[model samples]
Target: MKRKFLLLTTFCMMVLAACAPGGGSDSEESNAVSGDGGSGKQVLDFWYIDPGEKEKVYQEAVERFEEKHPDVEVKMLRVANDAYKQKLAVSMSGGNAPDIFNSWGGGWLKQFVDQGQVLDVTESIEKERFNELALDNTTFHDKIYGLPLGLSLDLVFYNKEIFEEYGLTPPETYTEWVEIIETLKENNIIPIALANQTKWPGAYYLMNFAARIGGPDLFNEAFLREGRGFDDPAYVEAGEYIQEMVEMDAFNPGFNGVPYDEGQGRQLLYSGQAAMMDITMSLVNNVRTEAPEFEEKMDFFVFPTVEGGQGSNKAVGASTGPVWSVAADTENPDLATELIQELTSQETAEAYTNRTGSLTAVSGVEPEDEFVNRMYQVAEEATHLQMPYDQTLPPELAELHKDTTQALFGLSITPEEAAEQMEAKAKEVLE
Candidate 1:
């Protein structure tokens, strides 16, 4: 009886010993914990779309954030701009969305907001610290969902040397601008460098044209379903302007075949083959890096006003840069929010502006470069800023807008047809 009792007692002690804290492997220990995952540190997954120097800035911010919070770890992931939206959607659908993700505000982020996938940071972020226009893109239903980090405005970037060689200066009116294109074409220079293969670049022309012709009221009415909608004459006239430019042979040969994100259009400007490109402000960094010497020859002007148009030249086609948003289901909400504050800190914003010559959302932050400052001034003084259709409209309608705009550029679809298609899609999706 005594031996049997000893044997059972020994077995029970052995079982208890095996289940103790030190008995398991390190990974097993991590899995046993609440949130440390075995590294004894809280881990937050952060995803962003900027891949080059901008990525480095984000890395530095992450490092700073980690240093400030020794108990936290941030795993920074860079997803390509082209693949980011789709990848984020897949992750969200699988219940594996990153704790923090970078996004373009407007309809792109609005979908996530509507799905309850985004956290409302209204109370966390101070509205007064950001530029109102920048914040406007991230705000939905009067609640702020993300932190605006920078502003992106489109302008006509021109080669000063090429302009001087042809005795041309920036135009003050749309008619004058068309005349400039004619002069450039007469000189055998591609008046504009556009990569419409990806479609968005060409859409800029139509967007800017419409904005200049009909003003904010036209687009506001169409978007809100309160007035004429996209089929309004203003949009059709915008298409006519693009077709006119096409007839003048203003764009590069096979412009519709080149891709903007690949730097093909910028190459045209660098080689002096094309005189100008209407693109986002990031062109400053692109020029500084791809062809440093060409930076000296670079200058910019806002889209000029159209004769007899309702929109002022002060109106600009712009959008917020990648805004940082916290996942609604993040495990470490406080940590994620703190990290965002660090990422958008004044030091970080200044560093980004100084390094890239682009405008950040941080109030009072401006580029130090004199030429870049001029572009910044334009954005600052803008009377009305129109967010790109792709970003402003829902995903389905946005794709249709880009497609129709591309078709317009290819001369495959009439402006009226494109406008009708847009209104139809908008009604189906929005109404």
Candidate 2:
């Protein structure tokens, strides 16, 4: 009996000893698996332009992405629009570039691609689902480099109350536009709110007018072709048109000294002091937030057409928004590609557009804001969408165009002289 009892005790002791170590091994294995989980906490550095009130939306998206990607951490860096390019260039040259960043289309992307600074995200992204022009803009030298997040069509925004008080509908042609200006002037309302001191905003008017008068293909061919210049009569005519408007008191007083953002031009429109302002679709959300009561009073239309011109009926401009690209030397190029693909997906594109009240690169996403919706419809119906002249032209030539346009506004130079100066500057650059 004693021997049998001792045998049972021995068997029990052996079973407990075996089970204890096995349980410990199981816990250790679980810790190992979790600590070294798939792809393991990769830190991605991302840079973008001013997110404004939309920063919250981006933050929420980042949180959701992290939840799904448990192994990845995203750090966002926001830069001011005016200084972004310089900062990016410095960062890239110093070997401290972010894993992902944003750029402008066409020449901007072309420069980066030529320098081998950005990764090719062509096959990585679903290009078949994006807007054709948006996709086209990011392609350079037969290679795809970036994904366009939004569309940026130029539209004329007018204050309904100001227009109603002066009894003006949106003009359909250049002649009608001139008449509207005259009518508004007689009624004591500034016809246009032009703030030329910042130069680019003023250049938008000049460049689009040139496109409307010269045809869409003309400037592209001239600017892109070797040994060509902006001496065309169309350029002169556009300059003259702006000069005429300036002489007619079309702009508010002290326009040349006003900054683009803080200028009286935007405030004038919101306060119903100005009849019209030419700006991007993105500005709609800003106007709504700044003047909620004036929300219903705002409307948009395309710039008036010029008679006997190739691009008379076309929309001549787009905004300078961010295009997403990956670092060419990323340690995880595949993962970087995946991130861009996700960022430019239909869902993300729509979220960006909806948040900014801007047009998305994705087709079939309707804008919720009435003005933005109308602008999108106008852009879609238009025959062509010309890249903004400043973007298309060489940087030196673009600066010349701005200076000449500002000179015309200041009466420091005649329209003929402005045209002559532009040709000279273009010649210097081309030579």
Candidate 3:
């Protein structure tokens, strides 16, 4: 099995190298919002990356928040996902950062925390109120910097109707998983609906596979230079697993060219052209919103265990959804803290979950929707919820990881080569 992958690696790399490193994000204008919007009320500018239905939910929450405060006004600014980091950086540098902003809680937020740009809200938030897994990224050096808004886990979401038609049950091991993929292919069905054109979508495979092969501590040890680092055999082996799948036609045709944000792969699932999707739990909201009828047919299973692997089957690839943190320089720390509390309060948590069909990090909030309940359970059961590499690693190394992983999926780089590239960069940056 591995020999086949070794034989295909060089050839695939040569054939696809020229087409790697897909396009960039479209430049967007971001105006620095001031805390004083000219209103007499105590104004608080809040920036977040949610733009559509999520914005609506936040707006409703803000309305209630206003109703409670009466004298304070919250200004909500929705920023584009790709443009947000730069926007926040610019605003923070200009000393006009929002009172509170949503941030991914790993290396992304750590930089701000290190620079004293983020407030340590440890006293403001009750540590016992959130799931420990959700707090992993936000807590640095024994202090919490942000409040997690939601929890997102990556798992294999399958179409129950399609599974029933084929008499297939979710697999519990890697070998069984491959059998399912092969079986799907035999029937001319796409085994997995993956949109790798954006790069990050495909990195999940490598992350989850590495977690299963090397267990939870592999990446962290490698990242901190305690172990073999990125050249760890687990990473290479994970890459090999991905390539084997690519050679076996596990993903859709032209998967390297499909963009996830455009809903291409999801469309396949919606049409039943694909059997399963190993994607984020956020897909729950999209399905419930755009294809409500399909919700009943959808269910998920955790990524299967690998034969003789050191990792637990319960380990998960997960990230806390945008966590809200107060700016360290805010003049009204008390008011800002109160607003953060209001936003992630029990009422808002329930409202957010109800409106989005997603799991909030708030403890004791069970999603009424059955499918989302499964996602919630998976998050609960996760022994090691690994944050995505791009978020957990520094910006430059993170980009390299995505690019090389994308190249790996495109088979434009051999597993060994990809691992080597990552190790070299990690050494340069971290050492």
Candidate achieving the largest lDDT: 1
Cα lDDT computed for each candidate against the true fold: 0.87, 0.74, 0.85
Q: Which stretches of candidate 1 lie over 4 Å from their true place?
A: 1-38
lDDT of 1 by residue, 224-257 (tens): 8997789999999999999988888889988888
Local lDDT at 262 for model 3: 71
Model with the higher lDDT, candidate 2 or 3: 3
* Model 2 local distance difference test score: 0.74
User: Which model is ahead, 2 or 3, in terms of TM-score?
Assistant: 3
Summed backbone clashes in each candidate are 1, 0, 0
Global fold similarity of model 1 (TM-score): 0.90
Error of 2 at 360 (Å): 0.7
C-alpha lDDT of candidate 3 relative to the true structure: 0.85
Candidate 1, clashing residue pairs? 30-38
Candidate 1 weakest lDDT stretch, 10 residues = 23-32
Order of models, best TM-score first: 1, 3, 2
lDDT by residue for model 3 over 1-431, one digit each (tens)?
79999879977996676435421111111222234434657888899886456677778878887898898988788887657889999888766788999997988888888889999899877888887878878899999999998888888899998889888999999899999998899998999999988788899999989999998999999888896699999999999999998999999999989987778889999999999999987787778667888888988898898987889878888888779999997867888888888778888888787778778888999988776777777777777778898888888899899899989888889999999999999999888
